[model samples]
Target: MVGLEMNELKKIGLGLTGFGVFFLFFGVIFFFDKGLLAVGNILFVSGVMTTIGVQSSLQFFTKRGNFKGTVSFGIGFFLVIIGWPVIGMAAEAYGFIILCSGFWSTISVFMQKIPVIGWLFQRFGLNQP
Candidate 1:
């Protein structure tokens, strides 16, 4: 039962994370609409927290190596909320790349299993492995 609940939670978390990314993409496509960007930021952060748990999320963000990324991300989020979507997204993108560098291998592996997308990644040399 506990395992089942955890699986469900993970599914939900993934959904939120996916939606967050979708919104962020659309936000950019829409010329960095502040509302969409802000919503994307919120959903992304909350989704990450949900997926990793609050304590782990805090630790990950507060780690010594992640300090710069964390600060940048936080400031970016703030800037977006205050109506500076372009610059805010730039900062957030930098921070997000830094913060997620460690997960690239894992992400690549996952991407490699996505059928057509996987083939595209491979063909484009985007597949790390």
Candidate 2:
């Protein structure tokens, strides 16, 4: 029962994360709309926390190696909330790249499992690992 609930929660978290990305994409498409970007940031952070659980999320974000990324991300989020979408997004992108660096390999592996995209990735030799 507990395992089932966890799986369900993860599914919901994934949904929220997907929506967050969707909003972020649209925000950029619409010339960095501040409201959309702010909502996206909120949803993304909440989704990540929900997906990983509060304690694990805290540990991951607060790790010594992640301190810089964490601070940058937080500042960027604040900037977005204050109506500086472009600059905030730039900072957030940098922070996101740094924070997700460790997960790139895993992400690449997952991407390589997709259908047409996976074929293209393989053909292009983008899946280094």
Model 1 lDDT tens row, 31-118: 9999998998888888888887788889999999999899988989999999999999999889989898889999889888999989
lDDT of 1: 0.88
lDDT of 1 at 95: 92
TM-score, every prediction: 0.82, 0.87
User: Which candidate leads the pack in TM-score?
Assistant: 2
Candidate 2, run of 10 with poorest lDDT: 1-10
Score each candidate by Cα lDDT: 0.88, 0.89
Residue pairs whose backbone atoms clash in candidate 2: none
What's the alpha carbon RMSD for model 1?
2.7
Candidate 2 at 78: error in angstroms?
A: 1.1
